[model samples]
Target: MTSHGTTTEECSPTPPTAEPATPSPGLYNADLAPTARKGRTWRSYSIFTLWANDVHSLGNYAFAIGLFALGLGGWQILLALGLGGVFLFLLLNLSGFMGEKTGVPFPVMSRIAFGIRGAQIPALVRGAVAVAWFGIQTYLASVVLRVLIVAVAPGTASWDTNRFLGLSTLGWISFLALWAVQMVIVSYGMELIRKYEAFAGPIILITMASLAIWMFGKAGGSIAWSTPATKTGFDMWRQIVGGASLWVAIYGTFVLNFCDFTRNAVSRRAIVRGNFFGIPLNMLLFGAIVVVLAGAQFKIDGKVIESPADIVKTVPDTFLLVLACLALLVLTVAVNLMANFVAPIYALSNLFPRVLDFRRAGLVSGVVGLVILPWNMYNSPAVISYFLGGLGALLGPLFGIVMADYWLVRRSRVDVPSLYSDRPGGPYHYARGVNVRAVVALVPTAAAALLMAFVPAFHAVSDFSWFIGAGLGVVVYLLVADRKGPFAEASGEAIAVPSKR
Candidate 1:
């Protein structure tokens, strides 16, 4: 999510403090604090590349095609995906500015609304959600490796014929190998991740564009758009809404976690500008390509191919198949390391501040993700729906709470020092380490949303759970919030982080 907010130094005064320990070591670990006022240097292009960083994965591609399974035509699916992209861009911009303005990560920014210590609740919530997707995405990435291995070494096909604990022997080998590859990249930290995206984004786009063009040519450059997927004449609107909602659910968690990325941007406009192209434009383009590819599959193969790996599997040219898999492998590794791995590391760090720095937190997150066997959870539509919807259920309320706190309650001013200070009665100090009100608001809202997600009878409403839960969170938080504070008005220190020497 590309969010909006002036960093604390940009718009709010520095609260009472000792020099903040330079980078705020330990209790106010500098890594977790508002970035230094003079250090914001990320530009618009950097922001645009983020979607490429996050979306260039097998799952994102499959998800685009899955939208068409709703029985909508290419045009309808495009519209829905584009609109969902717009919603994502807007929602992310709403949150992104706060990170830029405040120059702090999501959990740190949540202090005002959830309270300093209480902020951990949302942090852990997002972290757990990240872990789920992290493992799931990691598993999804390994599919490319599986394809590459089988394409090159046909004898390994027997591994697919056999099974153990939900995956075959070769599958297990590929998964662990891919997992290790990701761990290696993540260990190098964000700077390297940044460089990886910059390098891989263009190549991935070119490769997918080539595949789509090739498929379109084979299909005779024409597409027979499908009829309404779920309903007849007038009720087609419902199908479109359902499709759009699914896209939103896929997008829900990112907006909530966007602060982790936006905090690194040097200028507020950089994120917003990047988001304009990144979310709506990029999704439409990618979705169109996938829709065409799916449509082409009917002519080129037989049925709509669910996975691109299937497309690569059919390629008669060994060299071309290997090349496609290589692009995909690069894409998947980048997505796992950048999208799923980063936020969870921060979440875990927030959870055990003194004990777990980012590296240690990455170890903890990676370990937990491995134990969950995310592969078992990722392969089926029903399972994916339930899994992603459940995640959205948690995300919606957090998005609402944070948005409400930043936009309505605090009015954008934050006591930056108090966010890190251990002093009692500090601006964010509430109850004993937890803000009961935010909990009160988050629990039932999320519970109802979760039921909507997993309960078959309520499943029809599951896609909209994010929207509904967010509305509920806003109402509940508004009712319990303090009537006034420093953040009550939109006033603060105005200084940009200077360029680093």
Candidate 2:
């Protein structure tokens, strides 16, 4: 599958004895090294678990069920989700191959395309996006927890009356409680997270299946899979496209920083195998069950309920109610850690390698998540559409530039040590540690994407900002980058990595 150019086959079976032999104060750090082969312990199941935990969250469940409200049938929703899953799966493998081969996280990998110091720009952008989502996820989880507490105690329900900053008094307590729990768990580091994720993934899937079964019985086994045939032709096609875009948007956060997890993978095969089961298969199964639940609920009553937590609240059985709530709590924590927490930690560490380690970076991430007051951002559909959509616009062009630089321009060859060097003529040190071509490509494309997302006239295409930005980035970079400059200088210098051990 690989040769000397643009393929992981060039990677050594084992890493070097001492990768740096000497560290660069500003660029190289212990946390940023290429993972050693011995420490690459993640199997195919680990990757599967990672995606399972990431996908099976309350927000995602609500999203899948909500597509029905858009007038898409069950089969139609599945088709859109299925196509989106395949699209994401292909990209994950492409990026995962790089991480498995190099054993470096996304921030370190960015150095290849963005230059060492210039790498900070993409890193910070990714980190900021993560910060916003972290808060949103945490708040979502807190809402569920508060529901559970109210169900159990009832006295705590009084606290819901008082409001502050768009959240109730109980909401503040619940949010802070979940926030602290996450801070403690994440500070312990990735190994603990890896272990918990493997355990949490299957349990959440089972709980979801159980919920579907109970809801199915509630509707007496009769549920509508499709709405009445209302619109046809181009209008219907537009909904399908929009549904597919929503599916992809659901996973946009992981697209840039998947390498944060894949860097620990035992092999590229593991990543590919895991992603196959984790994404398309998992998404299909999960969507099917969600269809059953939403359909049954609609069958029993004419009203539509989008939030799974709210659906759980309507359950007559207390045991099932408590169980679903707990499962959702675990599911959100698992996703929050893997998707929102880890990426920012790595990004922040990369930005201030001299001042921050993983633990410190995680602390900063938690604080920023709180500061963002994500409850406000998530309270309104308009806010969510503008805020999150705008953030996503930034990443697409960055992804395009990175992928294009690795596969097209340099042909996958990377100078490992030079990435850590600020030496005047170092391979990655292009014009004072910043690649002008990348910046130029990024600014215009990102701006265009933001305009599409924020402007009312561009609403039709706003959902496609990521694709537009990425395509533009690829086209612009290819046109502007110095094809023969760094690639020629660092032609044969494959990475000699030494990661965990």
Among these predictions, the greatest lDDT belongs to 2
- Give the residue spans of candidate 1 off by over 4 A: 1-26, 155-166, 227-232, 300-302, 379-391, 488-501
- Report the lDDT tens digits of candidate 2 across residue range 213-299: 888888997787866642457877777777777677667667777888888887777888899999999989987887887788778
Number of the top TM-score candidate: 2
Q: Give each model's whole-structure lDDT.
A: 0.73, 0.80
**lDDT at position 472, candidate 1:** 83
TM-score of 1: 0.89
State every prediction's TM-score relative to the real structure.
0.89, 0.92
Total residue pair clashes for candidate 2: 3
Q: Write down the worst ten-residue block by lDDT for model 1.
A: 488-497
Clashing pairs in model 2, backbone N/Cα/C closer than 3 A = 6-411, 35-499, 36-499
